[model samples]
Target: MIPALRQDRGQAFPIYVVMVAGLLFLAFAFFAVGQASATRNGAQGAADSAALAAAQRAREELGLRFPGVLTAPGGLDDIFKDEGFVAAARDEAVSFGAKNHADLLPGGWQPHPGRTGQFEFTVTVQTQYTVGRSVIPGTEQDHAKASATAVIELRCGLPPGSGGDNAPAPPPVTITCDGQDVPVDPLPKLEKIFTVKLVD
Candidate 1:
């Protein structure tokens, strides 16, 4: 009877060992998946932030140069081609990407297709940190990347006859929005004039 019992215990021990080993492997696999997901989410967040920051910076530039845009000849065309405008936008993109633990790839900031005159910007970023060692192979050296697009669309408009060739706009500019008057000077009420958002 004692020998029979001993043999039964040995058989059960091997089954238990196999079950524990399988469970540990599953746990490691799940942990690796979680790590990968975290990296991907971080990359996406950085891209969205960088794009929005760039668009917002461009919006501010427009507000600062709003007076010239209204009175200068070919003003509408000139502001779009302004080197300073593009530079400011790119600076903001790079700054925001760094803040979010990512790097904006070269030429990663570009204009959106079929969407001219919207102050549109698309930003792409790669995570500064790689996914750490995991159960999955090659994950230790993997870096996540993501892209997002944000736009600064004009929401508020100037007063009637405030725009056009050689038409002088009156100030302090009284822009109306949501049933209230927003002043456009001493900072041009830019937030009121433009809506900044992530489109992609």
Candidate 2:
């Protein structure tokens, strides 16, 4: 009876070990799925940030900083017409994919004007990320999709010299003594009055 009990105990231990291993494998799979989802969300957030930054930069280059300026009202419209906001958004989508590690998806842009000269451009970026194929065996293919929309508005306060009438001041003139003759700066005033006779 004692010998039989020992043999049964050895068999039971192996079975218990196998069950524990299986449970651990399942737990690891669950963790992997959660991690993949988090990573996908992070990529989407990055895409949103990038799109907004690009739009802001484009608007800034177009001189859309001030609201009350005569050009500010139509500044975004001008940008959309001249620069093509939709195209810029598409470029941004590609950039986001490279920078954020996601597959680029469909997106678009729309121009909307706010109170006063404030202009806003709505930009949307969409992307998908593939995550988790292990543990589920046949369910290896899964995609997480995300979409981000941003409203980029022109900043208030006109930049320096934006509407100001102050032209660049005239350059200063310098006179130097060159031993043989006094050298005057090349200015219209000096050029008009001074004439040189060359002996050589």
Candidate 3:
């Protein structure tokens, strides 16, 4: 009886070792998956932030070019046509991406095409980063990237024109944003019309 018990114990030890090894492998796999997901989310956040920064900078540039109250006659051609506009946007995007621990890919900064005179300036940014160390075999280094877009609009309305002597003076056109009424002739405040959102 004693000899038989010893043999059974030896068999049980090998089975237990195999089970523990399998569980360890599964745990490592789950850890790798979680790390990859975290890296991807970080990359996406960096892209979104970078895109917003680019769009905000562009909006400020437009505001500077069109300071004060803007009438209907003026066009955005000059602002868009400036050679430095695109460069400035790209620089801002890269700067923001670096701040978020990501690097902007080559030619990752692009202005939306076929959008002219709409005051809808859109900028897309792609960013990539490496995960913390290499846990998974052949996956020690992974590239995670994402893109985002932002838009800026001009909000205004034409006041009714006075008719004749009997007609009362037209009320001043007002611009309100985020619940605050903007001054009728204040300096260009794109914050009132600018909106940043993640599109991808």
User: All candidates' TM-scores?
Assistant: 0.84, 0.53, 0.73
Please estimate how well model 1 matches the true structure, expressed as its whole-model Cα lDDT: 0.77
RMSD in angstroms between candidate 3 and the native structure over all alpha carbons:
5.9
Q: Least lDDT summed over 10 consecutive residues: which range in candidate 3?
A: 156-165
Among all candidates shown, the one with the greatest TM-score: 1
lDDT of 2 by residue, 53-123 (tens): 55544444444322222233342233334444445555564676557666554534444543342334444
In lDDT terms, how accurate is model 3? Answer: 0.60
Candidate 3 residue 135 C-alpha distance from true site, Å: 5.3
* Candidate 2's TM-score: 0.53
After aligning candidate 3 to the native by TM-score, how far in Å is the CA of 119 from where it should be?
A: 5.8
Candidate 1: segments with Cα more than 4 A from true spot: 74-83, 113-117, 165-188
Write one digit per residue (lDDT tens) for candidate 1, span 32-117. 99999999999999999999888888887787786566555543444555647768888999999999999988778896422444
Q: Which window of 10 residues has the lowest lDDT sum in candidate 1?
A: 70-79
In the range 161-186, model 3's lDDT, one tens digit per residue, is 42223333443345444565556565
What are the C-alpha RMSDs, in order, of all predicted structures?
2.9, 16.4, 5.9
